[model samples]
Structures are given as structure tokens and as C-alpha cells.
Target chain A: MWDGILTGLTTAVMPFNLLMVVVGCFAGTFIGMLPGLGPISAVALMIPITYGLDPASGIILMAGVYYGAVFGGSTSSILINAPGCASTVVTAFDGYPMAQQNKAGKALALAAYSSFTGGTIGAIILLFAAPALASVSLSFQSGDYFALMLLGLTAVAAFSGKGQVIKALLMTVFGLMIATVGTDITSGTTRFTFGSVDLIDGVSFLLLAMATFALTEVVMTVMRGQHNEQEPEMDMAALGSMKLSREEVKEVAPTIGRSSVFGFIVGVLPGAGATIASFLAYGLERNLASAKEKLKFGKGALRGLAAPESANNAASTGSFVPLLTLGIPGSGTTAIMLGALIAYGIQPGPRLFMDNPDVFWSVIISMYIGNLVLLILNLPLIPYISRLLAIPRPILIPLILFFSITGVYLVSFNTFDIQMMVLITVIAIFLKLLEFPMAPMLLGFILGGIMEKNLGRALTMTDGSFSFLWDRPLTLTITLIAVFVLLFPLLSAMIGKARTRGAEVAVNEGEG
Target chain B: MSITKDHIGGLVFLCLSVAYGYYAGQIPLLPGDEYEPFNAQSLPSALAIIGGVLSIALLVTADRSVEGRLKLAGYDFWLVAKLLLLVSLFAMALPWMGFTLSTILFLVGGYWLLGVRSIKTLLVASVPFAVVLWFLLSQLLDIYLAPGRFFTLMLGV
Candidate 1:
């Protein structure tokens, strides 16, 4: 473990990898300041540019972007009360108040410190926990893999949003269907290519990712008109020293600590990314703080800013856990990362830690370095980052479109893939207009191939018997957990709705 | 006019599921696979069946609260259509115009189409961006950005 860490640390320090971290952090922060672009889009957009990079370099860039985007969210939240993403909504809860009180610099400082603490602690946990989990997962077989993948799919579908469960699952199934294109691996026969030699190799992962994420995003941005983002009104006078007094640090220390742990735990859960973690952290702090301190929440409480900032950054790190160890993506960003791994022909699972230690360790070490760079660069540099918001939407959109085309083209120099990407993007936009969740579709697409491979293998081992699903204890246990997780929310929602209907009937009867 | 997005979406998925299931049956599978109970077509067929069920469920309980129309006659509608047109044009022209020229034209035309009026913004955003990216992708990364068959024939490079 120590050797891996050292290896990762050394790889992370190499000039090119270090440079990617800096560039990724800067770009992420700058882009995150935009009202419309969040970390997911930011990471997605960069995929084209990172296409030429090695896995370690790409992961470093991803880590930097994750941290920078989270911090950058604070900038918009604090300055304009418009968070770049939903996860930063809680940052605005107290951050804006602090700015209003002319303590903008103080708020920014606390946010930076708390983010660093959360991120660093999260990285530390990841360093130890990821490998341990990977080793434990060495026991995973075809059945276990199938169950885990199901659990991943279920968890994301269950929690992605309210009233979107069926839609999410349908999309997931559709993705699985899409994965069936081209030659069937085991059979060595064509499936869905329809006589097009272009698709005999199946659809490119880059094309699907670019289509669903980047291209769909471009269409939406153009159609929605401008975000009409308001100019950030940073209290320039309050942009003074970003120093934290001893008492101030002492006061928020416990809140940061608690939030970091809570955030890390929440982050590890599929579908519950930074937003939930931050909100939970803030709620926890509010509940535990003394009456006076509690009153300061959503007003100008330092702990208020500290808690969410820590949790969000911590949660971002925690989100990487499943993607690295299980080959299961927990969120849209991680799903894209999962796609990246597949593109590099490196299947990310338990074996990744053992087989591709350099890629795994380098990424892990880069996380530690990336967050450190963010902390160092955030303070005194935020005002400059805010300047990026002034870039017109029209200009940025076209440039992004250009990059999307170029990026997709780089993977395969053919024009057919580009054309397919555009067509898929249009379809994706229509789906989005109908309120479909894109994340699950992308996740399903990536996992569908893996799931089918494992499902077939598991059944094969059992001689075409479905009973093997239950004959294996661990697989059965995992599948049962998936079932419970899926049904629990649905059942609760149904019960709650029925009770509400019953109450309404009773009230009308009484009136009659 | 009273139809909602969910209604339309549900209908589309219902039809799509049937089509997908039919297509899955058309894909040939390996004969005599002793190692596995299922073939490549098995998972896709199962997915289509499950999708059909979900689509029916959606169609039955479809929400009508949200408005469904894209307002085809409206400005926003045209904006989307125009963007699509520009994208299609770029894709169609890529082989003739080459990566550099087509990208520049696409960005320029896209900006103008999207209503960016500032000439300076358009030029700075489109022309230089295309050139820099040409070098970055072609020169630095050694990605083969087609110089267009027309350009190749003309320049004989």
C-alpha cells in the first residue's frame, strides 16, 4: 500500500501531470463560475481535450476540475447569490449573507480552508479505503459482479430524482439495448450494425459520451437562450485579507470535521453526490450548534459556509470510490470517467488496483496534489476567476461545439461518427425536453456491456440454470439489497400518497 | 394542444420498445453456445420486454400537468431548428471544406445564427479559435484532421 502511494505520489509530481492539474483546476473554476456550466458539463467538455492524455494525466485533470468547480461554485454563490451548480446552493445560504455583511473575503477564506480540509481528509480516506475495498472485491465472481452492477443501477435510479424512477430505469434499459449494437463478442456475429461496416466494431464510447453529455448540452444552451447571468457584485472593499483569526478557525473546526465525515459517507452512496452531502452537513451543523450559533445559519454564520464547503469537496472525492474500485459509476461525472477508462481499454474494477496500479495510484496521488493546488490558488485569485463570467454565452457555446466536434473526430477520423453524434445529440435533447435523466442512460450504456458479459458468464458457469442467482449466497445477498433499495422508496411513496388521499376523503365526508 | 410531454414521451417509448424487441429478434445469435444459458440477443430482448412494460405503465399514468408543445412557430423553436441546420451543414461540408475552414465557418455561422451581433466577438471567437485548435489537434496531438479532398486535390500536398 505504501509502495503504491509512493508510486502515485511520484507520478503525480511529474511535470506534465502537474501541469494538467493546474490547467484543469483553472479551467474548472473559470467554467464553474458560469451560471449554466456545472462540474459535470465542465468535465464532459474537457474530455475532448484530454483525449490525447494518458490515463494518469487525464485522471489528474479530472480531480483538479472536480475540486476547482466546487470552489468556483462558491465564487458565484458568494458574489451573485447564483450558484454555478445545485451543490453550491448551500454555499449561497451563508456565503451571500457574509458578503452582505462585508465579510466576503472572510467567507471565501473559510470556504477555501474548509474545502481543503474536507478534500484532503477525503483523499486520505480514499488512499487507505480504496485498496482495502479492492482487495475485498478480489472475491467477486461473475454472480457477484452481476449483483453489484444491479445494485449500482438500482441505487442511481432510486435516488437520481423524484418521480423520475421509471423514466430513469427505462433510459437505463434503452442504453443496454444500444450497447447491443455491432458484433456480439462471444458469438462473433453481427447484431445491430444493419450492414454498415462502420458500426461492425460497435458505437464508439466517445461518440455516445459526447452525444449524451456535450452535444445535448450544446443544444439545450442554444435553445434555452442565454442563462442571462447577472454580473457578480463582489464587495471589492471586502476583498481584503483572506485571513482567518484563531477564534474563527477554532469555532468552525468541529463543523468542518463532522461535515467532512458526513460528506464522505454520503459521497460514497450512488446518486447522492455533492449537493446532498453539503445540505446534510449544513443541517447537521444547524441542529448541533448552540442556539446563538444556529441563529447565524443562513445569515452570516462562518460554520454555515464551512460545513457545506467541506462536505461538497469531500463528497466529490468520495464519489470516486465506486468508480475506481467497483467499475460502477455513482454519478454523471463518474459515469463519464468510467467511459474514459473503457476508452483507454482499461476495465476499471477490483483488478484495476492490481493490474493497473500506476493509473490507479497516480490518480489517487493527483487528488491530494490537486486539492492542495486549489486551496493555494483559490484565495487572492477568486476575483480574477470571476472575470471569466464576462465571456459572452454566444462565443462560449460555438467554441464548445467546435471542441466537441474536434474531440469526437480525434478518436476516429471518420465523418460518420461525427454525423451520428449530432443525430444522437438531437435525440438526447428531445429526451431531455421530456424530463429524462441523462446520467442513467450514460451509466446504463457503459455498464450494459459489462453487465451482459458478467450475466452470461455467471449463467454459463451454472449450465443455463437461473437458480444459480440464489445458489450463490453473496450474489443473492447483494441482489436482495438492490431489490429492497428499489422498492423501499416506491412503497413509501405509494403509502404516503394513499394516506393523503384517505385524509382528503375523510375531510370531504365530514363537511358533507 | 392538451397533450403533455409525458403523454408523448410515453407513447414514443411504447412504440420504440416494440420496434426494439422486433429488431432484437432479427439480430443473429451464435448456435450451440455450451458455456452460457443466454446468447447476445438474450439481454437485449429482455431489456426490450422490460422497456415495453415500463412504457405501458408510463402511458397509463402519464402526467398532463406540464405543457408538451415545442411551439413550432415560435422564435425559440426556430433557434433550435436553425442550430440543427447549421450543425447538419457543418457535418455535410466537412469533407469538402476541411477541418480548419469548416470549423471556422461553423463557429462563425453558428454565432451569427444564434444572434451574436458584435463583429469583434464573432471574429475573435471563431477565426482564431479554429486556427489554434487546428494546430493543437493536428500539430500537437497528431490527429489527422482532414484537409478536405478538394483541398488535397487543389494543393496536391
Candidate 2:
């Protein structure tokens, strides 16, 4: 283990590798600052570039981008009301208020430190834990894979909520169906290609993700227009000099430690990404803080501001564990990374770590470097980024649209992809109008293909017995866990609603 | 706004999935002696069945639910339609107009639709960004770009 750590550290110290980390962090920061363009998009745009590099170098660069983007997102959320993406929404609860209260620099500094701390700790845990988990997974058969996919799917309920649970389930099933389009791996049958030569290979999830998440986002931005109002320039000089007093640090220390653990566990679960983790952490923090302290949550309470920022950064690192060791991508960005690995002729599975330890460990080590880079950059750059709000909404929308369109087209140079983008964007708009969660849609798209492949393999191996799913203890346990997760929201909602029956109904009717 | 539209979309997707399952049935499978008996068509067909069942379920529930009856407002439809039109246009023009020109036009149209009325703000904000992207995507990264005929002809490289 020490040798592996030393190997990882040594690999990351190479001049070229260090340069890639710097570049990745710089690009990640810019991409995260832009609304609707998350770490996923940044990674997607960079995937093609990585095609030419060594596998270890490519993976490290992408990891840098992922960690760097989370750092960048916190700055925008703190300096302005804009969150850049869902993960930072909790940050905005206190971050924007900090800006308003004239402590933008201090808030930014604290956010940088907390994020660095959370992220580094998360990376260390991932480095130590992933290998042990991967070794256990080496014994996994088709049954285990099938059960794991089921576990991933059941996370929809835990993540999406009761009102939209059914829709999220159906959407996931639809994604699985869509995954069947193209030549089958075992049978070599042409499935849903629809006679289009382009689709014989199947719809690229990268293309689909870009269309669904990025392009659709552009359309929404256009519809919503710019909502941010320019504020007085945050005094850049005073920000750097401001320091966290010992008492103030004492108050937030517990919050940070609790949120870090919370975020790490949340990230361990499939489909539960940084956004949900951060939101859950903030909610927990709110419940724990004193009433006198609680009132300060939205008004720039240091703990409130720090909790989500730390949790989300930790969550981002945590999300990578399953993707690297299990070959199961927990989020859209990791899905794209998996695609990148596949394109390089590397299968991301339990064997991947044993087969290519340098690639796996180097990427892990690079994350440590990425977090440090983000901390250094964000601390001094908050005021510079805050000034960007002065750019009118009218002008910013067009530039955003341009990037969205150009980025997608450049991916495959396919015109048909653009048409698909339009179709998906339309569906996204309707989904948003109804307040449906987009994360589930993303999770569905990412996991859809893998679930189908494993399920197919499992059924074939079992010779038609549905009992195979129940035969294994580990598999059965996972399925039971999934069942419990699916039913959790319904059970909680019913009990909560029952208690407030009369008053809740009155309020509901009044709102309607 | 019509519950009918949602139901119709579901129905259409279901039928299409069934057709896809039939197509998957025709794809060649690996020889039975090598591994498992079930081949390519089985998984897809299973998914199709699940999709079909859920779609029907959604249609039925939507038919009964009053909330599904709400129609999209006029402005919503217009916004969606315009977005579709612009995306299709950008996709088609990309190979011909090049990334920069197509990006500029799309941005202008998008900003206008989104309520950015100032021409000056649009140009000033969009141009520099487009040039920077061109440099990053095309030059620094060495990504193969589909240059416009005009640019290619003018450069004569």
C-alpha cells in the first residue's frame, strides 16, 4: 500500500503531469463559473482531447477538471446568487448573503479552505478504500452485477422524491430501452437503429448527455433570461486581509466535520451526486445549530456557508470511487469518463486497478494536487469573478447558447445529433415546467446501458430461472436494500401528511 | 395542455419500442455452445415489455389525473418551438458556416428570444468569447474543424 502511494505520488510529480493538472484546474474553474456548464460538460469537452494521451495522463487530467470545477462553482455561488449548477445551490443559501453583507472575500477564503480540506480527505479515503472493495468485487459474478444495477436503479426513489418517483422510474426504464438500440453484444442483432447508418453503433451517451443536459440548459437560460442584478464591487483588498477568528472557526468546525462525513456517505450511494449530498448536509446542519444561530443560516452563517461547500467537494471525490473500481459510473460526468476509458481500449472494472494501477493511482494523486490548486486560485480570485455580474443578461445568454451548440456539434461532427438535441431540449423544458428532477434523468441515461448489459448477461447465465436473483445472499441483500429505498419516500410522506392532514390540505388548496 | 398529448407520446414511444424489440430479434447471436442460451434479443425485448407496460400505466394514470389536463400556455409553446427551430438550423449550418459564424448567429437569436434586446451588448459579449473558443477548440487542442468553404477558399493553404 505504501509502495502504491509512493508510485502515485511519483507519477503525479512529472512535469507534464503537473502541467496537465494546472491546465485542467484552470479550465475547470472557468467552465464551472459559467451557468448551466457543470463539471460534466467540462469533462465531456475535454474527453476528445484526452484521446491522444497516455491512459494515466488522460485520467489524471480529467480528475483535475472534476475536482477543480467543484472549487470554481463555490465562488460563483458565494459572490452572486447564481449557483452555476445544482451542487452549489446550498452554497448560495449563505454565500450570496455573505457577499451582500460585505464579507465576500472572507466567505470565499473559508469556502476554499473547507473545500480543500473536504476534498483531500475524501480523496485519501477513496485511495485506501477502493482497493479493498475492488478485491471483494473480484468474486462477483453476473448475479452480483445484475443486483448492483438494481441497487443503482432503486436509488431513484431516495434521490428523486414521492411526487415524481413514478416518473423517475419510468424514465429510467425508458433509458434502459433506449440502451438496447444497436447491435447486441451477445447476439449481434440490430435492435432499434431505425435503418440509420449512424445509429448502428448505438446512440452515444456522451452525445445524448450533451444534448439532454447542456443544450437543453441553453434553451432554458434563454427562456429564463438573466436574473442576477449587479451589486457594488466587493472591496477586493479588504477581503484577503479578513481572517476567521478562533471562536468563529470553533463554531464551524463541527459543522465541517459532520458535513464531510455526511457528504462522503451520500457520495458512496449510486445516483446520489454532490448536489443532493450538499442539500442533505445543509438540512442536517440547520437541524443541529441553535435557534439563535439558525436565524443566521440564510444571512451568511459561516457554518451554513461552509457545510454545503465542503460536502459537495467531498461528494465529488466520493462519486469517482465506484466508477474507477467497479466500472459503474455514479453520475453523468463519470459516465463520460468511462466512455473515454473505453475509447482507449481500457475496460473499467475490478480488473482495471490490477491491470493499470498507474492510471488509477495517478488520477487519485492528481486530485490531491487539483484541490490545492483550487484553494490557492479561489482565495484570491473571488472579487475578480464577482465583477462578471456586471455583464448584462441580454449579452451573456447569446454567448452561452453559442458554446452549447458549438460544443455538441464538435463532438461527432454529426448533424443528426443537433436534431436530437432539439428534441431532448423540448422534453427537458416540459420536465422543468413541471418541476421534475433532472438528476434522475441524467442518472438514468448514464446507467441505462450498463444495467441492460449486466441484466442480459445474468439472465443468460441463469438459464431462465428468475430465482437466480434470489439465490445469492449478497445480491438478495442489495435488492432488499433497493426495495426499502424505493418505499422510503412514500412511507415518510404518508406519515408526515397524516399528521398535518387538515392544515396541510387547507394550505394546499389556498396555494392552488 | 391536453392529457391526450402526453398519452399519445407515451403510446407512440411504446409502439416504437415494440418495433425495436422485433428488430433486435433479427440480430445474429453468438453460438449457443460457447456460453448462455439467451442471446441479444432477450434483454432488449424485456426492456421493451417494461417500457410498454409503464407507458400504458402512465397513460391510464394521466387519463384519470386532473393535473395532466393542464395545457401549455401560448408563450411556452412559442419558446419551445423557437428553441427547436434554432437547434435544427445550427446543426445543419455548422459544416458550412463553420463553428464561429454559426455560434454567433445562434447566440444572437437565443439572446433575443431570451429578452436580451440590446444589439451592442450581444455583439460585444458574444464575439470575443467565440474567438476564444475557436482558438481553444481548433488551434490549441488541434481538433479537426469543419471550416467554411469561404474561409478555406480564401486561405488557400
TM-score of predicted chain B, candidate 1 = 0.81
> What Cα-based lDDT does every candidate model obtain?
0.82, 0.73
DockQ of each: 0.63, 0.44
lDDT of model number 2: 0.73
- The segments of candidate 1 whose C-alpha lies over 4 angstroms from its true place after superposition are A227-241, A290-295, A498-512, B33-36, B64-75, B118-121, B154-157
Question: Model 2: which docking level applies?
Answer: acceptable
B89-139: candidate 1 lDDT, tens digit per residue = 887889998988898889989888767788887888878878887898779
Check candidate 2 and list the clashing pairs: A187-B28, A187-B29, A189-B27, B1-B70, B1-B71, B1-B72
Candidate fnat values, all: 0.75, 0.64
Q: After superposition, how far is residue A294 of candidate 2 from its true place, in Å?
A: 3.4
The CA lDDT at B39 in model 2 is 59
Over 4 Å off in model 2, which ranges? A227-241, A388-396, A434-436, A494-512, B1-37, B56-84, B94-157
Q: Candidate 2 lDDT, tens digit per residue, B1-157?
A: 3554456546655785677667656656656723564656666667667767766765665543556554555334566577669778877777778878977787777667666777886786667767887898779988877787667778864
Clashes by residue pair, model 1: none
What shift in Å separates residue B69 of candidate 2 from its native position after superposition? 6.9
